[model samples]
Target: MTTPAPTALQRPDGSPLRILVVDDEQMLTDLLSMALKMEGWEVRSAASGFEALSLAREFEPDAMVLDIMMPDLDGMSVLQRLRQSGDDVPVLFLTAKDSVGDRVAGLTAGGDDYVTKPFSLEEVVARLRGLMRRAGTATAGGADPVLRVGDLTLNEDSHEIERGGTSIELTATEFELLRYLMRNQRRVVSKAQILDRVWNYDFGGRSSVVELYISYLRKKIDAGREPLIHTVRGVGYMIKAPQ
Candidate 1:
């Protein structure tokens, strides 16, 4: 029996969400495209990183399923270039390398999620649905689409952030981390919570990834300014407006 489409797959306008599937393997790309289309989503596939980059600009997809081991330009390079160009589209990395370091590299390079190859199509679909929901929340229309703490401003709809009137570029992962911290400003958030919410992984006892991304955020959002991210010492991390 075919799985039913999740309600979250629909956009705010009631249109189907668009997804770009990128893989060097033609068979994998075709398989993913067919599966995503079954969920009533608009699916586009690219067999190489170059084509993926080009289609991403023109398609402006809501999310992307990217393969890590591509010839010429790999998935990490494609994602990094996209983040540099200020495209905050959510990306899920597919790879045969399931090591801890591999996952960390993908997340640090700005991917929102990761899936090992020989993965279940159901799991991939579920992960994509989760990503779509999170992205929707970030860009959801409301009376206030922007979050603020001190001089730092994050516009959810535009995926833009500014601090002290200076624009700050953030990768998709960085943006999500900052948003979570800003949402709970003044409240300490544990590393476990961050891993679950931001990375969508449960690394347990391996919370170094949180520290790394926090440092990345600090370099961009806190450097040369009054520090906003603070370690609670023996606890977690917190962000608050400067006194």
Candidate 2:
């Protein structure tokens, strides 16, 4: 119900991002609310699908995060209802199941992307940013910013990623990390930089989470393809089309 501070421009760390979180777990929702607030985003939460629908109209968030399984009204149904009402707000689905079929199903149901359970708060933040970016909601006027590397293209507005003529499906976190790398293409970015920018953190700087996420990204964005995200030895990461 509270609106964010009006600003002529968005702040990097303090930009007021309005987000709605739909999940049945009270504990998880509380944790998410706290984390989002810490990042300067205005957050509203609903514990069920019906509640989400009610809050959606009232809050009218810039983006929404939905949990797949719920009592009474499920996440998919809630999304369908929203779309039926002509609301195009970007949606990021969350689920415990990480199967390929489940991922594809969520996308097919009109979700922008899906994040599996057991995810870190950092990953969730990155995913939400990616979803907002893809929805053309990152910048004022709802215009998407283009990120490119040679022929590779990432449309933050359309949630579309393409290389040559092929399209790729990237998780929320992958999309943000890829966008950041592409923004600084051909330059080596240390893990510290990546963590700070993409994950918005500055503590315990020795976790392997970044590496694990990079591997996940490689499978989806690189793997059998010309590697775009490259390891920079004992430093961090870099994204450049193989030359």
Candidate 3:
């Protein structure tokens, strides 16, 4: 999964990144609010779907963390309403269900990503950061948002990656994975860290996906060339400039 910005990202106008958190539970809302604020982001939490909708229109957040099950309109319904009105803000769904079908439904309902309930605050932050990365925002100083390691280059604005002057096509997931690896560059990031930053989940029933994507990246990035992506057996993975 491509990781989001290594540095804090902000609005084009040089304002703090605006985030909206929508959930029914007051304590959870507060906790999420605090976590988001600690990121130096401007946050507004809504306790109900109605309040969420209201804040969404008025606040115009860059991204949102929305609970699937709410007391009034429900998260899905709220999302539908927003889509109908052309509010295309990126959303990270909060769900209590771990079923594959349910998670698929959330994505099908237009969620950018999801985290099952009983989630860690860090997961939410990482997911939202990734969403905004793809959603398009400005860096604080607006430096060119391109990453390079060896002859490989990944362009954030264009969603493009190139190697040795050749353009390479990548699926959304693959791009995310590569982006994350490139951001950390030479550091040996473990599977647990990759799972949190890339997949938006903690370690458990999932892990093989990390290896899976690493191979995918190797095929596209390191194949037939001086290897840049490597596996440190018994540890995790790292991508580096050809030595």
Candidates' C-alpha lDDT = 0.84, 0.77, 0.84
Taking the tens digit of each residue's C-alpha lDDT, what string does model 1 give over 1-243?
Answer: 111223434777767789999998888888888889998889999988999999999999999999999997999999999999999999999999967788888988899998887987877887887687776722232346678888888876688999989999999999989987886788899997788667776585789989999999999999989999999998899999877
- Candidate 1, residue 178: the lDDT equals 95
For model 1, the superposed segments whose C-alpha errors exceed 4 Å read 1-5, 137-199, 202-243
lDDT of 2 by residue, 66-104 (tens): 999999899999999999999988998888986667877
* Residue-level lDDT for 145 in candidate 3: 75
Best by TM-score: 3
Q: Backbone clash tally for model 2? A: 1
Error of 3 at 13 (Å): 2.3
| Clashing pairs for predicted structure model 2, backbone only | 134-156
> Once model 3 is optimally superposed onto the true structure by TM-score, how far is the C-alpha of residue 115 displaced, in angstroms?
1.2
> Which of candidates 2 and 3 reaches a greater TM-score?
3
Candidate 3 residues 1-243, lDDT tens each? 343355667887888999999988889989999998988899999988999999999999999899989888899999999999999999999979877677778888888888888989987887787788777753535667788888899987788899999999998889988888888888888887787667654547577988898888888887899998989888889888866
Displacement of the residue 61 alpha carbon in candidate 1, Å: 0.3
